[model samples]
Target: MSKAFSAIDEDREVDRDAFTPGVEPQPTWCPGCGDFGVLKALKGAMAELGKDPEEILLATGIGCSGKLNSYFDSYGFHTIHGRSLPVARAAKLANHDLEVVAAGGDGDGYGIGGNHFMHTARENHDITYIVFNNEVFGLTKGQTSPTSPKGHKSKTQPHGSAKSPIRPLSLSMTSGASYVARTAAVNPNQAKDILVEAIQHDGFAHVDFLTQCPTWNKDAKQYVPYVDVQESDEYDFDVTDRREAQELMTETEEALYDGTVLTGRYYQDEQRPSYQAEKQSRGDMPEEPVAKRYFDDDYEWERSFDVIDRHK
Candidate 1:
């Protein structure tokens, strides 16, 4: 999918509209799709952070979320299924200055992409990962996803799902993500704020965004009147407390199926050094961006490519 692409100038003052493509293509996601909320919140977060479109790299996998790069005006890669994290990690490694983000659906991220998600978090990579958790494979015509509720009925499992849903927040916390959050599409303000914090975070930040699929999974409960863990007087837990966060996340994950949707930032670790920073501190990573070296030696690399071709 490599092709010549142009970038927006860096010196221009960052505006919300700067992220919109010059020739904007209308999103094909179904009307009332929760994806629209994500797009809006993301644009708002980027604008708030004063991030130029050229300074960010958005990597997406094969799912409805993959179309994000097409609509958002940024340096992007539409990677293969379950591969967005690897691509995002590579981009971050090559240029620490680039803001890297990976987005995918629950099926794409928690199923086949589960391994990458685990290791990336374990390594504390410097990137923001957004998993659109709508409870089904929206792009594959509403199949049961890894996060689908137990006993949920789908075409793939007309008898209902026999397996329990994987606890995303618990998994993320246990897997070593430095920053963890859960936000819903129904709450755009909170979503934007969480995204802003996630992007600014230096270590791996995993946001399990609860999106609604109106066309599919009609049996799901309406996601409204959610309680923000941060704003609610009923729930009190320190955001920096891992054990407390784990307990709260368990309840939050369970409540989703019990007709209560809880949304908010649950955990954050500020002292942990990111994978890049740790490597650079040990003199393992280059002082300057590796991309600069690649560009400067482009002609020599091309000659080497020709030499390999002759051997073949």
Candidate 2:
């Protein structure tokens, strides 16, 4: 185990309320917003794992999801649009001990920020990334989001969107996420359990969180009466096998627009090393926190100019 997780006191009991902001302001998200479920599940998962709030770092991009850190009370960075992943990556690189998480809406993550999403997964950064997919941009007055269904009308696409929705689970798997799963607001218990596992996972964990936007996405199909593939005998596939998981993900993505909401773990690679792990193995990364090196007066560090002078 890395020093990050090994430092935690397993017997310590962390209260869920410890995550609440000092002001304890209620979330400003629209009533019945799917984001509420995510917040609850996160708090529950952290508490269940006995993680201290101080050890966590939540980085969120522009949109309603960015408000998460305000309510989560963790070390937070409310970043610019479609840039949470890079920001989160920098933090993890500087201080690998922090349990980092990045969050954003579908439009923020899958649309404008898609490039970052792909590379971050390909590198297998050690962080949890949650994409709140509501099909429309609720905070921006109900525009078509990246996950919006074909023929789904919005202010931006008044005649209805012609673009096929991005297959997030498939994309995550293809881009090289070590862990991938889908969960919904309607299933809080399952969501909580998944979050716990995702946070516990050692590599890049991507969760396509289905969130309902009642005000903006009233046209969205209700996520109720969902099927859990893990518990259902009808669906049996090993999460560790790439071939099996790939086929299952393809079906699940198609089933979503067809009105069948399939939510569950799709794939995991416990053997894959994370980006930091690879760097450490190559001797390119320091075993201790890079931030800590600044405080060590005895530590000699090479300057950028020194390397340039040597080469000249």
- Highest lDDT scorer: 2
Per-residue alpha-carbon lDDT of candidate 2 for residues 153-223, written as tens digits (9 for 90 to 100):
99999998999999999999999999999999999999999999999999999999999999889977557
Model 2: what TM-score? Answer: 0.94
Q: How many backbone clashes does every candidate have?
A: 0, 0
lDDT of 1 by residue, 82-127 (tens): 9999999999998787888999999999998999999999999999
Cα displacement (Å) at residue 203, model 1: 0.6
RMSD to the hidden true structure, all candidates: 4.8, 2.8
Q: How much is 126 displaced in model 1, in angstroms? A: 0.4
TM-score of each: 0.91, 0.94
What are the runs in model 1 whose C-alpha is more than 4 Å off?
Answer: 1-13, 295-312
